[model samples]
Target: MTKRTLYLFGSAAPPVFDIARVIEEAQARGWDVCLGLTPAAAEWLADGLDGLAALTGHPVRSRYKRPGEPDVWPTADAILVAPATFNTVNAWALGLTDRFVVGVVAEGIGKNIPIAAMPCVNAAYVRHRAFERSVQELREMGVTVLYGEGGFVPNQPGRREPYPWDRALDAVDGLAPAAE
Candidate 1:
């Protein structure tokens, strides 16, 4: 089975529930799945990690270090940054991995792991020069940023629709040759 590590960033609201579903689908197709949550996001999605773990049958991680638990750090074939919030996106684009989610993404880049970033934010923020610059920087550094229409939610005012799952899966498939 292809190992898939889903890095879930919840720096904002709306929870990336759709992205969660995509990861779940990937898991069903035999990809080993794991999740990383941001501190702010942990508050937003109460029990969400448990639900994701239940669906994926893998532990959801939110910390950068667990001194005695290295086994929890499963290797990954690809990394998906669903609902990439402004804070997380900007931080990552600038090489700031102080948080768990961003840190995993940094590791992926270091190891040449394929990465897909799905940006979720308001039109105003999306139009911001700084934000646009950050996205460009990410692309320039070889991160594939999935483009899609965004919407407003009660908790997540700038939530985008789910990214194209088929394409994401295709990316994962392209990562390796078939096992004979």
Candidate 2:
């Protein structure tokens, strides 16, 4: 069995080709991909998700704790939170799992599942004291917070070179052997 991977994304960011490319490449290499997005993210851009689901043959999810859903509660080998918004990051860092996105994240963290967050917040919020504290809390909790380039600034739409999808998969592969 291939490793299970969840591609989680936040709301309100332009779509990047790197993400879709990563999913395709990973799947080609025999990884079972799962997708999760914030509610706002669905509103912002969920256009090609059905295509993605067809490619992976797994149900794409936006909610966290729904009972009786056929694909509910699947264990993931890794969780990659891409374009992680400041709101979602802070909420997850501070144990604020009010919504499905955060709730799934909290559950992943609790289970010691490897999580990689590609935060794409504006400069101002990243530099705020509260934001730093929340990030620190996440780091302290063993969550791998991929720091954006230039540290933190207010209003800068982060540099997108190192998306870390492959890196996260490598780490997960190391942590748990892929199912045969």
RMSD of each: 4.1, 3.5
Over 4 Å off in model 1, which ranges?
Answer: 1-11, 67-71, 148-170, 173-180
- Poorly placed runs, candidate 2 (over 4 Å): 1-4, 7-11, 15-18, 68-73, 148-180
Model 2 shows how many backbone clashes? 8
lDDT by residue (1-180, candidate 1, tens digit) is: 434454444455464556477776766656666766777776666567688778667776666776675666567666767667788889899888889899878778889888877666766666667888888888888887765433222123344543455665555555542344
lDDT on C-alpha atoms for all candidate structures: 0.66, 0.64
Candidate 1, residue 47: CA error in Å?
A: 2.6
TM-scores of all predicted structures: 0.78, 0.77
TM-score of 2: 0.77
Backbone clash tally (model 1): 0
Give the worst 10-residue stretch by lDDT in candidate 2.
148-157
